[model samples]
Target: MAGRTLIFTGPPGSGKGTQAAHMRDRLGFVPLSSGDTLRAEIKAGSDIGKQAAQYVQAGTLVPDDIITGVMLAAVSRQPTSAGVILDGFPRTVGQAEALDDGLAAAGRKVDAVIDFRIDDGLIVERIVNRRICKNCGATYNIRFCPPKVANVCDRCGGELMQRVDDREDVIRTRLATYREQTTPLIEFYDRRGLLRSVDASREAPAVESDVVALIEALG
Candidate 1:
């Protein structure tokens, strides 16, 4: 059977990435996070990653074409049977169009776009509390899921550090950029009747339940 493809979009710290992981664990879908994929490529030292690294090192965003190429390649690698949960991709209308073209060529398309709706102030707070394992990359929020020991990762016994982007000023800028860029993309999906939303202001489990119900309804 053909697999469904979903695009999860929202401001940073909305927990959409965590929900993507949850869906992958519970339903066997493959999660393709653009950030994770890029990081992996950079870690692997691939040519694409090399290109991406230049911009990353410069503290600028990776160009859309390069990101689109990596994301399309990522999509093509998975079997048509494993549903794809796309996280942190198609950040622009041009990239979204490219994704549409690429998927159309493969007889597939984005089945839905889940907008994780939350307030910007809440997102800033959430991100400010976020920390990640320096070794294993596990994420935690001090306000919610802090480790057993302060500044230590419970899973890997590694030190936990706050990412630079998790700062309040940077997060506010990112939220502003997200709102500006995602407005058109959200409208693009809405016009296609594939846009759905979950209240991310709620706890993660509650948001996930709504997503699961939406998925079942889609079936």
Candidate 2:
């Protein structure tokens, strides 16, 4: 059987990445995160990374070609029968089209697009209360998943600190950008009958179960 490809999308604090990671771990799928992939390339300072950095540093969208190239390369690395979970790509309708085109060239298509739904208010609250390990990058939430010791990582014994960008004003701005840019992408997938929304305000396990059931239904 051909691999199942799915896209997980949402605002910053909506747990889309967590759900995508769950699907990847439990189902043996590769999780390809556009942000993470691009960041890696940028850190490596490759030619393409430098090109991407120009756009990123300028606070503009990386040209669709560059982003699409990264996504295509990631897909090429995976086996034909290995499902792929896309996280944090296709932020705009144009990127969505680019993804479809790239996948078509590879003789694959997106099986489903899972949009995690949560309100902006809750997103702000969730993000502000969250902290990350300075050493190992493990994430914790003050309200949801506090560490064993206060303000420290349970796994790595690292200091946990809040990101500067996680402040309320920055989060609100990100939400505004999401509504402006990402909503159209959601509509694009909905038009193609590939969009399924999961209530992301629920706990992680519940959302993961909903996603698994949705993919199984697609089969």
Candidate 3:
């Protein structure tokens, strides 16, 4: 529970973001999501953002170096007291090494890496049924966590719609790529004794409880 950096990884639709939100609140740490940071930079038209915008527009993944630089910059700016909860960053082994180096330079290192293990069939179903609020980016699973009204966001009253990438084929490709690229990162953390595996097939509250327990056990 003390200030420490934590990285979370999982395939798309695995509820990593939901758990990250819980950890951020419970631990009082900044949740640093690489996707959110990159989007913000791209919106601001920063130098790196311009480069990232091209890949994003073309539906290509941003290069590892660009993502590493952006993430390191974000980590450097985090307040010392709160530390950080990293999500959707270090997708590759190279980026993981770069992140470690960045943290070393900052006089810190990764405290833990939590990987959410879930079945691909479940992921496909979850993505297909998922609805997101365009205004606040809040996600709800139609089958599991439907909004107050159909196609409506409970928090903001925003119109909810399925994301294009959440389609069947796209979800398959994303899960495949995640397995291909992120498996090594998982091993990398595991070797360092910082990896914690959680069953993501259960309910969100159960998964969050497991993660909290794991962190407490580590302490």
- Winning model by lDDT: 1
If scored against the real structure, what TM-score would every candidate get?
A: 0.84, 0.85, 0.82
The positional error of residue 93 in candidate 1, measured at the CA in angstroms, is 0.7
The total of clashing pairs for model 2 equals 0
TM-score ranking of the models: 2, 1, 3
List the global CA lDDT of all models: 0.89, 0.88, 0.87
The per-candidate count of clashes, in order, stands at: 0, 0, 0
- Cα displacement (angstroms), candidate 2, residue 123, comes to 1.2
Q: What TM-score does structure 3 among the candidates reach? A: 0.82
**Model 2: CA > 4 A from native:** 42-50, 53-61, 132-140, 145-161
Question: 17-75 in candidate 3: lDDT tens per residue?
Answer: 98998887886768889989898778988787788889999999789988887777777
Overall local distance difference test of candidate 1? 0.89
Alpha carbon lDDT at 22, candidate 1: 93
Task: Enumerate residue pairs that collide in model 1.
Answer: none
Better of 1 and 2 by TM-score: 2
Q: On residues 19-85, what C-alpha lDDT tens digit does candidate 1 reach at each position?
A: 9999998888888999899887777777777888888999997999889877777787788887998
Per-residue error for 97 in candidate 3, Å, reads 0.8
